[model samples]
Target chain A: MSSQAFTGGHKASHQELPPEFQDQEESIKITGFWMFIVTDVLIFASLFATYAVFVNRIASGPTPAQVFQLNTALIETLILLTSSFTIGIAIWAMRQNRQRMVTWWLVLTVLLGMAFVSIELTEFAGDVAAGWGWHTSAFLSAFFLLVAAHGTHVTMGIIWAVALLFQLRRRGLTTVTRRKLYTFSLYWHFLDIMWVFIFTVVYLGGRLI
Target chain B: MHGGDEQHETAIEPGFDFISPRFEEPKFPMHQVWGYAASLVLTFAALWMTVNRIMSPSVLLGVVLAMAVGQAALQLGVFMHVRESRGPAWHLVPLGLAFAIGIGLVGMSAWIMLFKSGVS
Candidate 1:
């Protein structure tokens, strides 16, 4: 019975993975990363959907156009876009084995990321000070959740990149460093992408509505 | 140009293995160069449309949301390389979840718009 069960399990495994691609370690991790991205995508998608549901709700509160400062948002957008480009160049520097260039570029990216978050938080503070609290309306609640989620991710990305900088400083560019950098780039780009949506939907759509 | 000896340009032999780390700088720099440019244009164009509420409020809202979705797709597919990653099928799995989100959004919107006051 034990031998039969073993054979059955082997056959099941073989059916799942072909012979040539049977390596478990690398393929699993790559697939796992993809799955992780998909899950994150769903999280954002749900947020988007929620925003859509209550988009018209103001509860006699401030609307997007009245609340969101287009100029400030534009400034924040520029900051994030430039930082992404700088980080991309930093990755290129890493590829070229230019350590000092990498460090400086990453430092610039961190500062820019911080600048974006501070401006965003300031905008939120201004909103609250203007008597438009998160509880004021369904729209405000959804807006806070979505934008705050993205802001939190950016803050986390800055921290993660700085930590990577420290690791690179201590150990130089090893395979581990390369993998970390690759993951960080993925994250930074993801943040940029989410910003694109937030800017378009929240800022723009809110004004239009 | 001064290869008068038998050792011509073709005679040069690299010391390393035939398949070395192909670390030549990116040939198709278009992806790197154009990625952010496209993003900026899309973002600004969206912002321009939003500024001053350029059209009917409802229509503008819908357009902005649609454009945002497009922008997000560009960022995810191009910048994040989500679709081009090793296991794209795994990434595609979220489509189902997004569909569920759509259903939930429509349902919740209807509930809130049509029934929330009645229930309260």
Candidate 2:
């Protein structure tokens, strides 16, 4: 389908668009990705709603203020935020057809993402070893579910970035590859946006009186 | 009309084709740099406000939530290129509706569960 879309562009593309949108079908695919993001928005919304409900339900365990560490969460937040900026810059480089710049920035972004996931895992491990698991209370359950979901998304993103790096190597910058990278950047930024809320409503809100 | 029949069909064709395109003028990404800086400021401000208890608890919560929304908007526009389109920007319609529903879901759930709410 992608090859077909690429070929279709050369003859019929009247509108000068970014390389990703040079193919009409691929532009529709971009819109489809947006729809996918809309669904994701709802998915996270439900979890956030659940988290809000259970946030105060510490049956026999620590409260969020007791469990969450401001310093660590702040570091993780900044790392992920910087990775988001790096990916945005990567896409900017892709538009200019600078493969090396895009590749270097993507590598940096992936490394940052790995750092975030590892830090989160270590945090969770520390909690579990100290005997605070999701089973401890409704609040813990909600916290784990909401945050783990985002962590899982980040894990998946790391994998996707590695895969995209491979594709960029094999295919160089084509319309198809450009679209894929652009969509991934969109997903990354969306995740950061979600994290902004998580940092606010979950981490920071947990520290509130 | 170079082709009379083509022009005739255009006269009869529906205008609801959403596949319209727009030019994406390339420039230096100062937007990204400013967005990153602004986002950092917002994060630290939220943290500081939370830590210092600079306002009443509820008011601080409200302020931080507003900042989160602003940060999301900044990333969406500057980084995600939400307004750039090869289509009619129909995405903004669904994405907007999604936010409305998502925000309503979070706010309503928090409000409804006020029965279980208290200090951290």
lDDT of 1: 0.66
Q: How many clashes show up per model?
A: 0, 0
lDDT of 1 by residue, B1-120 (tens): 232222221221355222121122342335556767876786777777766567887777667667666666665554444432211133444544654665476447535765545532
Complex DockQ per candidate: 0.16, 0.43
Candidate 2 DockQ score? 0.43
Candidate 1 structure quality by residue, lDDT tens digits, A80-144: 88788777767656655667887898899999999999999999999899888889999899999
Q: What is candidate 1's TM-score for chain A?
A: 0.84
For model 2, fnat equals: 0.65
Which run of 10 residues does model 2 chain B get worst, by summed lDDT? B4-13
* lDDT score for candidate 2 against the true structure: 0.84
Q: How many Å off is the CA of A77 in candidate 1?
A: 1.5
Per DockQ, the best of the predicted structures is: 2
**What's the residue-level lDDT of A126 in candidate 2?**
96
Q: Which structure among the candidates has the greatest TM-score?
A: 2
TM-score against native, each model: 0.73, 0.88
Local error of candidate 1 at A136, Å?
Answer: 2.1
lDDT (Cα, 0-100) at A2 in candidate 2: 23
